[model samples]
Target: MLANRVSKRLLVGLQPVFKTPHVLPSSYLSAQNARKFSISSKCYQEQSPEPSDGESSASKKKDEGSRYYVPSSQKRKPLSRVTIGSSTDNARFRRASDTIEFSSWKAGILFVTLGTGLYFFFRYQKEKMDLQRNEESNRGYGKPLIGGPFNLIDQDGNPFSSDNLLNKFSLVYFGFTHCPDICPDELDKMSACLDILKSKYNIDIQPIFITCDPARDSPEILKEYLYEFHKDIIGLTGPYEDIKNICKAYRVYFSTPPDLKPGQDYLVDHSIYFYLMDKDGEFIDALGRNYTEETMAEHIKNHVDAFVSKEIREKRKQGWFSFLY
Candidate 1:
């Protein structure tokens, strides 16, 4: 009875400690006994939902994390603003290029349109002028000479023209002294013909040798080359255009090498005919390349005498001494 009373007294005394406002140890305290209870309770709490009663902190944290995780463009890590900014930069560049292209295209179209308009306008005016010119030309007679004013350089590097041959007839031949087969042979035949003309009728005439190969025949080159031929034969050379025009004027045929490759030498094939020009520089006769000095003179003297009176022909034909007259 006494033991029961003491035990009862101990239990009643412990109830005061248990029921009173005693300070509880923190959950982090890991006494050997406390650690066992903490592990078991932590696992249990993880399995169970955390209490939402009273405290909003847990819910606030969950809301914050979820906000960051929410997908903007289908859960991509990159943000919508970042994607938009990159896309915007690309779009801006494209827009700038497009603007430049549009402006350039617009300018081109405007220029082309303006040019077309002007071209048609000038063309219409030209047609009207041509019609009036045709009517006026029809009122007048005579076939106009088919030729344009040509600029050319002569034997002495001076400009020679029909004016240079004024008061004198010209014997224009396309030949080069270096030409082994045709040029020298043809020139010799011409010289023989001229000699025959000298016997029958001596005329103050000019024979010109134009080079086919300018690379080998400048003014200096031609001067030395003509020494092999008749002393009276004048040599001529110039730039390509001058040579081309001179040849064209006399209907002399000459062509360039298809490709003028550097460091390669090529030959030219040209007409072998000699041209006879009147005192006015009009094309008169084309002599055969096969003519000898006798035959050539035979053809020339008659024409020279035909153009002038007998007295004038006699006086002019006395060449080299006619100046004495």
Candidate 2:
């Protein structure tokens, strides 16, 4: 019975020490035991204090981390403002992209312009060189080096000289009547060009064929051979030395073929070119084998037209001066 009472007192004392809000069963504790429990409760209450709001928040941050935390003063921008900022940035990017493309286009145009300029520049230089060559050909070795005084027998056995070239534009060819292919072809082209010039441009050019092989090409032979060719062409033949001097003076190269036998008829190798001579026996131009009859006629027409225009201008100027006087 005493042991039961002591156990009851121990339970009641522990209730006060625990400070539980629930009501305890009736019990009685010894004074010493109750005093000891009260002292232990007071010491525990003094040692452990309530935590502040700051300390609690710090502990929460340590446990859950700062990722979920948001400051009270900071707030999100509205949807409209965010959208406007993004749109402005996109517009700037587009403008930058367009500017780059425009610059690239301008650079490409500049490159093409430079390339075209270079192409035209080179073409102009090439045309200038061709013009210089034509000028040189027109001038010959110098002023009037090709045509000069030469007394030779024509196809009619009449004497012909540089005087015959006065007041008439002449087309001269140096070849042998015995030339199988080259001379015939060139003479035919000359005849065709002459017809075209006369009919189309009213330029009646006199044609002349001077023989390089005078040994075989007598005046009678030349007349007979030229009969089958153009009627207007006059054939000229002379002594070997005279013909040689004429050829040298005109810069016409001619040589006997290497395969010539002592008695066999051989061909004459000669430089082929149609010499266009103005009045007064001045060389105007030399047309090469590459020129067609039509091309030659056209070239002659251009020169004749230029000459006629120049004559008209000079006449007008002279008339004005005479009137003034």
Candidate 3:
């Protein structure tokens, strides 16, 4: 066998003075002594040549299958694998993070809801106080005045003469069925305001819509138009001269375009206003434009509250409460 002087030599302890027989000598000893003894590494400093510049154990490992190596049959230990989580475990962690994000997102919505609730609460309370002030301060009609009145017809097609509507609070306006937009919109507002009045404040005020365009808004037209807006609204269309006199009495100005074609697009120029009257058929205050539905309803509700209180006072004086039996 060739000597392995080119490789790094393993250290051997030469007990220079031997006490045990299984001891080893220096690497210079013959191969016969290499396997003949076991040595304690603590007792020796191996003698090696000055190593070449790049020669390393790794480079020496590349010398496998050279004339020096003797392969061993021992297998290396298998690597240890420590698993952390299953696939579902990762998914559940992601879901938990999503749930936290969702909770934070909905927290903003809850804050907005609470802020809106507080705003409404303050606005509602302010409106209530204003309504009370109006009911107490304005003794007649509790709204602005816009027009006077004349003889008219009721919803039963009966004459809604001044004598009939005089003993109650009245809201009056003038428009015709042939009006393109303004009439229907005004009447609808009045109806919507009244519906809110009845439901929210139990006001039962009378409303009248007298036709300025009597040529097209006949009693039948008036009836159908009234039905389209509100059941309680009374409509009237009488003789042209009489209606003109009524218009003059209420100070309502209306005129039709001169060159209108048959069933053509036409409009009636009239003052848009609300005329509020007292229980004595007498014109009082009125409300002009720019007031919203709730504000208008508030005005009427205040008037009705005053009117009802007066009625109750009078009835109490007459001992009417005893009739509950």
Candidate achieving the largest lDDT? 2
TM-score of each predicted structure versus truth: 0.47, 0.52, 0.48
The parts of candidate 3 lying over 4 Å away from their true place are: 1-149, 154-156, 258-265, 306-325
| Residue pairs in clash, model 3 | 144-285, 144-286, 145-285, 145-286, 152-160
User: Model 1 compared with the native: what TM-score?
Assistant: 0.47
Count of clashing pairs, candidate 3: 5
What's the C-alpha lDDT at position 60 in model 2? 38
> Tell me, what's the RMSD of every candidate?
35.1, 32.4, 27.4
Q: Mind giving the per-residue lDDT tens digits that candidate 2 earns over 1-325?
A: 3444444466454432432213322232233235434443443355436433433433333343223323465332211211222445344334445442533778689889999999999996665545534543565553556767788999999999978987888899999988989889988899899889988878899899999999899999999998788999999998889898889878999997676667788888888998877665667688889999999999876655444222443475489564421
Best by TM-score, which number?
Answer: 2
C-alpha positional error of residue 96 in candidate 1 after TM-score superposition, expressed in Å: 99
The local distance difference test score of each candidate is 0.58, 0.70, 0.61
What order do you get sorting by TM-score, best first? 2, 3, 1
